[model samples]
Target: MKKYILDLPEFILVALSAYWFLENYIGTNHFNPYAFIVFAMLLLQIYFKNKYVGFLLAWFISLFSLYMVLAVISEFRDFPTLISEGALKLLAFGLGFCFLAMGSAVLMFYKYFPKVFPARF
Candidate 1:
Protein backbone atom coordinates (compact mmCIF):
# COMPACT_ATOMS: atom_id res chain seq x y z
CA MET A 1 0.00 0.00 0.00
CA LYS A 2 2.86 2.33 0.80
CA LYS A 3 4.52 1.51 -2.51
CA TYR A 4 1.27 2.15 -4.34
CA ILE A 5 0.98 5.50 -2.62
CA LEU A 6 4.50 6.35 -3.72
CA ASP A 7 3.57 5.53 -7.31
CA LEU A 8 0.46 7.73 -7.22
CA PRO A 9 2.20 10.72 -8.81
CA GLU A 10 3.26 8.71 -11.83
CA PHE A 11 -0.25 7.32 -12.18
CA ILE A 12 -1.73 10.81 -11.97
CA LEU A 13 0.69 12.02 -14.64
CA VAL A 14 -0.23 9.18 -16.96
CA ALA A 15 -3.96 9.81 -16.55
CA LEU A 16 -3.54 13.55 -17.08
CA SER A 17 -1.42 12.95 -20.18
CA ALA A 18 -4.01 10.62 -21.67
CA TYR A 19 -6.77 13.14 -21.02
CA TRP A 20 -4.76 15.94 -22.61
CA PHE A 21 -4.09 13.85 -25.69
CA LEU A 22 -7.74 12.98 -26.07
CA GLU A 23 -8.86 16.54 -25.46
CA ASN A 24 -6.54 17.87 -28.14
CA TYR A 25 -7.50 15.14 -30.59
CA ILE A 26 -11.23 15.70 -30.20
CA GLY A 27 -11.36 19.41 -29.63
CA THR A 28 -8.61 20.81 -31.87
CA ASN A 29 -8.24 17.94 -34.36
CA HIS A 30 -4.48 18.20 -34.07
CA PHE A 31 -1.65 16.43 -32.34
CA ASN A 32 -0.16 17.94 -29.21
CA PRO A 33 3.66 17.76 -28.95
CA TYR A 34 3.60 17.48 -25.18
CA ALA A 35 1.39 14.43 -25.53
CA PHE A 36 4.19 12.61 -27.32
CA ILE A 37 6.64 13.34 -24.53
CA VAL A 38 4.10 12.31 -21.94
CA PHE A 39 3.48 9.01 -23.69
CA ALA A 40 7.18 8.37 -24.04
CA MET A 41 7.74 9.02 -20.36
CA LEU A 42 4.86 6.74 -19.44
CA LEU A 43 6.20 3.96 -21.58
CA LEU A 44 9.70 4.40 -20.23
CA GLN A 45 8.40 4.28 -16.70
CA ILE A 46 6.58 1.05 -17.41
CA TYR A 47 9.62 -0.48 -19.06
CA PHE A 48 12.17 0.59 -16.48
CA LYS A 49 10.10 0.69 -13.31
CA ASN A 50 12.56 3.25 -12.06
CA LYS A 51 12.06 6.24 -9.85
CA TYR A 52 14.18 8.27 -12.25
CA VAL A 53 11.39 8.08 -14.79
CA GLY A 54 8.97 9.56 -12.30
CA PHE A 55 11.50 12.30 -11.56
CA LEU A 56 11.67 13.15 -15.23
CA LEU A 57 7.90 13.31 -15.52
CA ALA A 58 7.71 15.46 -12.44
CA TRP A 59 10.44 17.72 -13.84
CA PHE A 60 8.47 18.24 -17.04
CA ILE A 61 5.33 19.02 -15.06
CA SER A 62 7.22 21.40 -12.82
CA LEU A 63 8.52 23.33 -15.80
CA PHE A 64 5.02 23.71 -17.17
CA SER A 65 3.71 24.70 -13.76
CA LEU A 66 6.42 27.35 -13.45
CA TYR A 67 5.45 28.73 -16.84
CA MET A 68 1.81 28.84 -15.78
CA VAL A 69 2.72 30.72 -12.62
CA LEU A 70 4.62 33.30 -14.64
CA ALA A 71 1.79 33.68 -17.13
CA VAL A 72 -0.76 34.16 -14.35
CA ILE A 73 1.43 36.67 -12.57
CA SER A 74 1.77 38.69 -15.77
CA GLU A 75 -2.00 38.65 -16.21
CA PHE A 76 -2.39 39.97 -12.68
CA ARG A 77 -1.21 43.37 -13.83
CA ASP A 78 -4.69 43.69 -15.32
CA PHE A 79 -6.48 42.96 -12.09
CA PRO A 80 -9.80 44.22 -13.35
CA THR A 81 -9.77 41.72 -16.18
CA LEU A 82 -9.24 38.86 -13.74
CA ILE A 83 -12.07 40.12 -11.57
CA SER A 84 -14.34 40.31 -14.60
CA GLU A 85 -13.42 36.71 -15.43
CA GLY A 86 -14.73 35.62 -12.02
CA ALA A 87 -13.98 32.06 -10.85
CA LEU A 88 -12.18 30.87 -13.96
CA LYS A 89 -8.94 32.65 -13.21
CA LEU A 90 -9.10 31.61 -9.59
CA LEU A 91 -9.62 28.01 -10.57
CA ALA A 92 -6.67 28.05 -12.91
CA PHE A 93 -4.51 29.60 -10.23
CA GLY A 94 -5.53 26.94 -7.76
CA LEU A 95 -4.69 24.14 -10.18
CA GLY A 96 -1.35 25.74 -10.95
CA PHE A 97 -0.50 25.86 -7.25
CA CYS A 98 -1.47 22.23 -6.87
CA PHE A 99 0.80 21.25 -9.73
CA LEU A 100 3.62 23.26 -8.22
CA ALA A 101 3.15 21.55 -4.87
CA MET A 102 3.08 18.08 -6.42
CA GLY A 103 6.19 18.79 -8.45
CA SER A 104 8.01 20.01 -5.33
CA ALA A 105 7.04 16.89 -3.43
CA VAL A 106 8.33 14.60 -6.18
CA LEU A 107 11.61 16.49 -6.29
CA MET A 108 12.02 16.30 -2.53
CA PHE A 109 11.42 12.56 -2.63
CA TYR A 110 14.16 12.11 -5.17
CA LYS A 111 16.49 14.34 -3.20
CA TYR A 112 16.05 12.45 0.02
CA PHE A 113 16.09 9.01 -1.55
CA PRO A 114 18.98 9.35 -3.95
CA LYS A 115 19.65 5.63 -4.01
CA VAL A 116 16.09 4.99 -5.06
CA PHE A 117 16.29 7.32 -8.03
CA PRO A 118 19.61 6.43 -9.57
CA ALA A 119 20.69 7.97 -12.85
CA ARG A 120 20.10 5.73 -15.82
CA PHE A 121 23.03 7.22 -17.67
Candidate 2:
Protein backbone atom coordinates (compact mmCIF):
# COMPACT_ATOMS: atom_id res chain seq x y z
CA MET A 1 0.00 0.00 0.00
CA LYS A 2 2.68 2.48 0.99
CA LYS A 3 4.88 1.32 -1.89
CA TYR A 4 2.11 1.74 -4.40
CA ILE A 5 1.44 5.26 -3.22
CA LEU A 6 5.10 6.16 -3.63
CA ASP A 7 5.16 4.66 -7.13
CA LEU A 8 2.05 6.42 -8.35
CA PRO A 9 3.95 9.30 -9.91
CA GLU A 10 6.14 6.95 -11.92
CA PHE A 11 3.08 5.12 -13.17
CA ILE A 12 1.50 8.42 -14.16
CA LEU A 13 4.64 9.46 -16.01
CA VAL A 14 4.69 6.18 -17.95
CA ALA A 15 1.03 6.49 -18.84
CA LEU A 16 1.43 10.06 -19.98
CA SER A 17 4.47 9.21 -22.06
CA ALA A 18 2.64 6.34 -23.73
CA TYR A 19 -0.35 8.55 -24.47
CA TRP A 20 1.82 11.28 -25.94
CA PHE A 21 3.69 8.77 -28.07
CA LEU A 22 0.48 7.32 -29.46
CA GLU A 23 -0.96 10.78 -30.01
CA ASN A 24 2.05 11.72 -32.09
CA TYR A 25 2.11 8.42 -33.96
CA ILE A 26 -1.58 8.25 -34.84
CA GLY A 27 -2.83 11.80 -34.36
CA THR A 28 -0.61 13.35 -36.98
CA ASN A 29 -0.03 12.51 -40.61
CA HIS A 30 3.68 13.08 -40.33
CA PHE A 31 5.86 10.87 -38.14
CA ASN A 32 7.62 12.69 -35.32
CA PRO A 33 11.07 11.29 -34.51
CA TYR A 34 11.27 13.11 -31.23
CA ALA A 35 8.09 11.48 -29.98
CA PHE A 36 9.46 8.09 -30.91
CA ILE A 37 12.69 8.80 -29.09
CA VAL A 38 10.84 9.79 -25.94
CA PHE A 39 8.73 6.66 -26.11
CA ALA A 40 11.85 4.49 -26.51
CA MET A 41 13.67 6.10 -23.61
CA LEU A 42 10.63 5.66 -21.39
CA LEU A 43 10.41 2.00 -22.37
CA LEU A 44 14.04 1.50 -21.45
CA GLN A 45 13.40 2.82 -17.98
CA ILE A 46 10.24 0.80 -17.53
CA TYR A 47 11.69 -2.53 -18.60
CA PHE A 48 15.29 -2.23 -17.46
CA LYS A 49 14.80 -0.53 -14.10
CA ASN A 50 17.85 1.53 -14.87
CA LYS A 51 18.12 4.49 -12.53
CA TYR A 52 20.19 6.47 -15.01
CA VAL A 53 17.68 5.76 -17.74
CA GLY A 54 14.85 6.95 -15.53
CA PHE A 55 16.75 10.11 -14.75
CA LEU A 56 17.36 10.82 -18.41
CA LEU A 57 13.72 10.13 -19.25
CA ALA A 58 12.46 12.46 -16.55
CA TRP A 59 14.86 15.18 -17.61
CA PHE A 60 13.72 14.90 -21.22
CA ILE A 61 10.05 15.00 -20.26
CA SER A 62 10.52 18.06 -18.07
CA LEU A 63 12.46 19.94 -20.69
CA PHE A 64 10.05 19.00 -23.48
CA SER A 65 7.05 20.02 -21.42
CA LEU A 66 8.62 23.38 -20.66
CA TYR A 67 9.36 23.90 -24.32
CA MET A 68 5.80 23.00 -25.26
CA VAL A 69 4.37 25.44 -22.74
CA LEU A 70 6.55 28.26 -24.02
CA ALA A 71 5.76 27.47 -27.65
CA VAL A 72 2.01 27.35 -26.99
CA ILE A 73 2.05 30.59 -25.04
CA SER A 74 3.94 32.37 -27.77
CA GLU A 75 1.75 31.01 -30.53
CA PHE A 76 -1.58 31.49 -28.78
CA ARG A 77 -1.07 34.80 -27.05
CA ASP A 78 -4.28 36.18 -28.49
CA PHE A 79 -6.95 34.23 -26.63
CA PRO A 80 -9.79 36.14 -28.24
CA THR A 81 -8.44 35.39 -31.70
CA LEU A 82 -8.25 31.66 -30.95
CA ILE A 83 -11.74 31.66 -29.45
CA SER A 84 -13.10 33.00 -32.71
CA GLU A 85 -11.53 30.20 -34.71
CA GLY A 86 -13.44 27.00 -33.92
CA ALA A 87 -10.91 24.26 -34.67
CA LEU A 88 -7.94 26.36 -33.70
CA LYS A 89 -9.49 27.01 -30.30
CA LEU A 90 -9.96 23.31 -29.71
CA LEU A 91 -6.43 22.54 -30.86
CA ALA A 92 -4.98 25.19 -28.57
CA PHE A 93 -6.94 23.88 -25.60
CA GLY A 94 -5.86 20.30 -26.26
CA LEU A 95 -2.20 21.23 -26.57
CA GLY A 96 -2.33 23.36 -23.44
CA PHE A 97 -3.85 20.53 -21.45
CA CYS A 98 -1.27 18.01 -22.64
CA PHE A 99 1.61 20.32 -21.75
CA LEU A 100 0.12 21.10 -18.35
CA ALA A 101 -0.38 17.42 -17.56
CA MET A 102 3.19 16.58 -18.49
CA GLY A 103 4.51 19.53 -16.51
CA SER A 104 2.53 18.52 -13.43
CA ALA A 105 3.74 14.92 -13.60
CA VAL A 106 7.36 16.04 -13.84
CA LEU A 107 6.90 18.38 -10.90
CA MET A 108 5.36 15.63 -8.82
CA PHE A 109 8.29 13.31 -9.50
CA TYR A 110 10.80 16.02 -8.71
CA LYS A 111 9.11 16.90 -5.45
CA TYR A 112 8.39 13.40 -4.18
CA PHE A 113 11.21 11.29 -5.62
CA PRO A 114 14.14 13.63 -5.80
CA LYS A 115 16.69 10.91 -5.20
CA VAL A 116 15.62 9.01 -8.27
CA PHE A 117 16.84 11.79 -10.51
CA PRO A 118 20.54 11.55 -11.30
CA ALA A 119 22.96 14.44 -11.18
CA ARG A 120 24.70 15.60 -14.34
CA PHE A 121 28.46 15.12 -14.36
Candidate 3:
Protein backbone atom coordinates (compact mmCIF):
# COMPACT_ATOMS: atom_id res chain seq x y z
CA MET A 1 0.00 0.00 0.00
CA LYS A 2 1.25 3.48 -0.74
CA LYS A 3 1.64 6.03 2.06
CA TYR A 4 -1.47 8.12 1.71
CA ILE A 5 0.03 10.75 3.95
CA LEU A 6 2.05 11.72 0.94
CA ASP A 7 -1.07 13.21 -0.53
CA LEU A 8 -2.28 15.09 2.54
CA PRO A 9 -1.61 18.59 1.28
CA GLU A 10 -3.26 17.95 -2.05
CA PHE A 11 -6.29 16.30 -0.56
CA ILE A 12 -6.83 19.17 1.84
CA LEU A 13 -6.44 21.73 -0.90
CA VAL A 14 -8.68 20.04 -3.46
CA ALA A 15 -11.43 19.08 -1.05
CA LEU A 16 -11.44 22.59 0.37
CA SER A 17 -11.49 24.08 -3.10
CA ALA A 18 -14.49 22.03 -4.07
CA TYR A 19 -16.20 22.89 -0.84
CA TRP A 20 -15.68 26.61 -1.20
CA PHE A 21 -16.56 26.69 -4.87
CA LEU A 22 -19.75 24.81 -4.25
CA GLU A 23 -20.73 27.04 -1.36
CA ASN A 24 -19.95 30.27 -3.14
CA TYR A 25 -21.42 29.31 -6.47
CA ILE A 26 -24.39 27.31 -5.31
CA GLY A 27 -25.11 29.23 -2.13
CA THR A 28 -25.58 25.95 -0.41
CA ASN A 29 -24.95 24.96 3.19
CA HIS A 30 -23.72 21.43 2.57
CA PHE A 31 -21.40 19.63 0.24
CA ASN A 32 -22.89 17.03 -2.02
CA PRO A 33 -20.78 14.14 -0.83
CA TYR A 34 -21.75 12.01 -3.80
CA ALA A 35 -20.06 14.37 -6.17
CA PHE A 36 -16.65 13.93 -4.55
CA ILE A 37 -17.04 10.16 -4.42
CA VAL A 38 -17.75 10.14 -8.10
CA PHE A 39 -14.68 12.26 -8.69
CA ALA A 40 -12.57 9.79 -6.74
CA MET A 41 -13.78 6.92 -8.84
CA LEU A 42 -13.18 8.78 -12.07
CA LEU A 43 -9.67 9.64 -11.01
CA LEU A 44 -8.88 6.03 -10.24
CA GLN A 45 -10.29 4.68 -13.46
CA ILE A 46 -8.73 7.31 -15.66
CA TYR A 47 -5.30 7.37 -14.09
CA PHE A 48 -4.73 3.64 -14.48
CA LYS A 49 -2.28 3.09 -11.63
CA ASN A 50 0.27 5.82 -12.07
CA LYS A 51 2.08 7.60 -9.21
CA TYR A 52 1.54 10.92 -10.90
CA VAL A 53 -2.15 10.15 -10.77
CA GLY A 54 -1.81 10.18 -7.02
CA PHE A 55 -0.30 13.62 -7.24
CA LEU A 56 -3.13 14.82 -9.38
CA LEU A 57 -5.72 13.55 -6.93
CA ALA A 58 -3.80 15.19 -4.16
CA TRP A 59 -3.83 18.49 -5.99
CA PHE A 60 -7.53 18.25 -6.56
CA ILE A 61 -8.17 17.36 -2.97
CA SER A 62 -6.12 20.32 -1.86
CA LEU A 63 -8.15 22.64 -4.02
CA PHE A 64 -11.31 21.20 -2.56
CA SER A 65 -10.12 21.61 1.00
CA LEU A 66 -9.06 25.16 0.37
CA TYR A 67 -12.56 25.93 -0.75
CA MET A 68 -14.11 24.40 2.33
CA VAL A 69 -11.90 26.39 4.66
CA LEU A 70 -12.62 29.57 2.82
CA ALA A 71 -16.33 29.00 3.05
CA VAL A 72 -16.21 28.35 6.75
CA ILE A 73 -14.09 31.40 7.36
CA SER A 74 -16.37 33.64 5.36
CA GLU A 75 -19.47 32.33 7.02
CA PHE A 76 -17.98 32.58 10.45
CA ARG A 77 -17.01 36.17 9.87
CA ASP A 78 -20.31 37.34 8.46
CA PHE A 79 -22.78 35.45 10.60
CA PRO A 80 -21.22 33.52 13.40
CA THR A 81 -24.53 33.05 15.14
CA LEU A 82 -26.27 32.07 11.97
CA ILE A 83 -23.76 29.35 11.26
CA SER A 84 -24.36 25.90 12.61
CA GLU A 85 -21.16 25.03 14.43
CA GLY A 86 -22.02 21.36 14.28
CA ALA A 87 -22.20 21.46 10.53
CA LEU A 88 -18.80 22.98 10.20
CA LYS A 89 -17.30 20.54 12.66
CA LEU A 90 -18.91 17.56 11.01
CA LEU A 91 -17.83 18.60 7.55
CA ALA A 92 -14.28 19.06 8.70
CA PHE A 93 -14.22 15.72 10.43
CA GLY A 94 -15.75 13.83 7.58
CA LEU A 95 -13.63 15.40 4.90
CA GLY A 96 -10.37 15.09 6.80
CA PHE A 97 -10.90 11.50 7.91
CA CYS A 98 -12.28 10.03 4.72
CA PHE A 99 -9.93 11.78 2.34
CA LEU A 100 -6.94 10.73 4.42
CA ALA A 101 -8.16 7.17 4.49
CA MET A 102 -8.65 7.04 0.74
CA GLY A 103 -5.38 8.77 -0.04
CA SER A 104 -3.50 6.49 2.36
CA ALA A 105 -5.05 3.43 0.81
CA VAL A 106 -3.81 4.52 -2.59
CA LEU A 107 -0.33 5.17 -1.29
CA MET A 108 -0.26 1.87 0.55
CA PHE A 109 -1.22 -0.02 -2.56
CA TYR A 110 1.55 1.66 -4.49
CA LYS A 111 4.01 1.10 -1.69
CA TYR A 112 3.36 -2.62 -1.32
CA PHE A 113 1.65 -3.66 -4.50
CA PRO A 114 4.10 -2.49 -7.07
CA LYS A 115 2.34 -4.62 -9.62
CA VAL A 116 -0.66 -2.41 -9.16
CA PHE A 117 1.31 0.82 -9.29
CA PRO A 118 3.85 -0.46 -11.74
CA ALA A 119 6.64 1.56 -13.21
CA ARG A 120 5.43 2.49 -16.63
CA PHE A 121 6.39 3.95 -20.01
The C-alpha RMSD in Å for every predicted model, in order, reads 4.5, 4.6, 8.5
Could you arrange the candidates by lDDT from highest to lowest? 1, 2, 3
The residue-by-residue lDDT of candidate 2 on 1-121, one tens digit each, is 8756645655666676677778877888667786677667655655665655665666666777777767776676656565568547656785866666576557545644556645767
**Candidate 1 residue pairs in clash (backbone atoms < 3 Å):** none
Give the top-scoring candidate (TM-score).
1
Residue 66, model 3: lDDT of 63
TM-score of each: 0.66, 0.63, 0.38
Indicate which candidate wins on lDDT. Answer: 1
lDDT of 2 at 111: 45
Candidate 1 ranges beyond 4 A from true positions:
75-80, 85-90, 93-112, 116-121
In model 2, the Cα lDDT at residue 19 comes to 76
In order, what lDDT does every prediction score?
0.65, 0.64, 0.53
The predicted structure with the larger lDDT, 1 or 3, is 1
